[model samples]
Target: MPRTAPAVCSAVHKTDPDRPRRAADGLNLCRGCLKGMHRNLSDLPWLHAEVVTSMPTTRATGSAPVSGSRTPGLPVNLRAGELHSQMGHDLRTIAGWVAKDRGIHLPVDGRVGSVCAWLAKHVNWLAASQYAADVRGVLTELVGRAWAVIDPDRRPMEVGPCVELVDSTPCDGMLWASVLDVGDPRPSKIWCDGCELELTPEQWYRFGRRYEARRRMSA
Candidate 1:
């Protein structure tokens, strides 16, 4: 008996001619190309990649009747469906919080280029905290979410779209507020009652030292 060859990867499959999971895009991608693209979609630097679109069909096709028939975007690692999901926003919000918390400072944009640049620069020296002990862990999670969005078959973890700072007890709103002139007046914004007591004695001490250090830096 002779063996039957598998289907060729020439064009996008029928289920989704726009987005192909099991095949690679090209005039005719070989089995190797398909596999490589699949693997690289979730590989390292995947988090650093962005999904972008080409210009309108008129620019490329020289046809006016096909005005609405703009060329479909080809995303080797990005897709519309993936960027709009829980995983997509969760990773992005976490990046913002981590950057703000560590003073790395990446803009709160969903695009990967700028965020990845910031990640590249500060990931080495960014001090770990209770929220993000492992920087790589968060990066991995981010990549996982990106992969999940691009590839429907892969099951990704559930995530909150927005990450918030929560107190152990229910939030009752700010008890009081004060401002100090440390060269600049920045409010000591306390969000809840008893929130001050939630920190351990050591944590408070460390925080005090940091606050004083910043004050001195400003001075």
Candidate 2:
């Protein structure tokens, strides 16, 4: 028997060299990509639900006379509405294609949650088929969009120790930023756990610059 070359992952990643060449025997995507796809598929239902729930709506405060333009008011959050629709449409379209191709019975109602559950269940099976890249791409895009709408500031990070100096003494606390605050006006809040110091979103950049300067001076 002759040895065959391994198939490269079809999924695009930030770093090409780090992509795994050891894809499953019959799949074009690596194990990592497939795992991520499954996880995202599972999360899609929740994310889509969040997007729907978080959509901003307006109610008649007092039923004032509307004679200015005679136009109907639209949904307050058009972006959220668009995202919600796209998520459902994409999930149903892909699921339908997969069902037809695999001869599997899809959910008759084609609800977003049902379609997502179906996709998550057969993610590996899809990975082995010719539509691996298409499925992965769609899943990734939908997941990213869903997150952007519901939790745009979810990437909390430790921004190094507290650099706030009090009488030539640095506060012995750690500074962190980007606390999860869905629909919050102030998402980028930097705070210290030890000294109880806090910085607003507007001051975060200045604080970072000052911290860097302090580091340079100490070095």
What are the Cα lDDT values of the candidates? Answer: 0.36, 0.68
TM-score of each model, paired residue for residue: 0.28, 0.59
For all the candidates, what are their Cα RMSDs to the real structure?
A: 24.1, 12.0
Error of 2 at 80 (Å): 1.2
Q: Kindly list the per-residue Cα lDDT of model 2 for residues 1-219, writing each as its tens digit.
A: 633323866766433445344566668776556766875676677678878865765222344434454557764557678889998888888888788998888888777888887788788778877778788888878876766666444534678766666335554556667565577553356665334466787876776787799878876
Candidate 2: deviation at residue 65, Å?
A: 24
Q: Which candidate comes out best when scored by lDDT?
A: 2
Task: Estimate the overall C-alpha local distance difference test score of candidate 1.
Answer: 0.36
Off by over 4 Å in 2: 1-6, 17-20, 57-74, 153-219
lDDT of 1 by residue, 1-219 (tens): 532222333323222334322212221332323322222223423333322221112222233344455455442223434443433455466567666776665665655544444444443232222332233334445554554443232222221111112222222222222222356332233112212222233554665565456446655
- The residue pairs in collision within model 1 are none
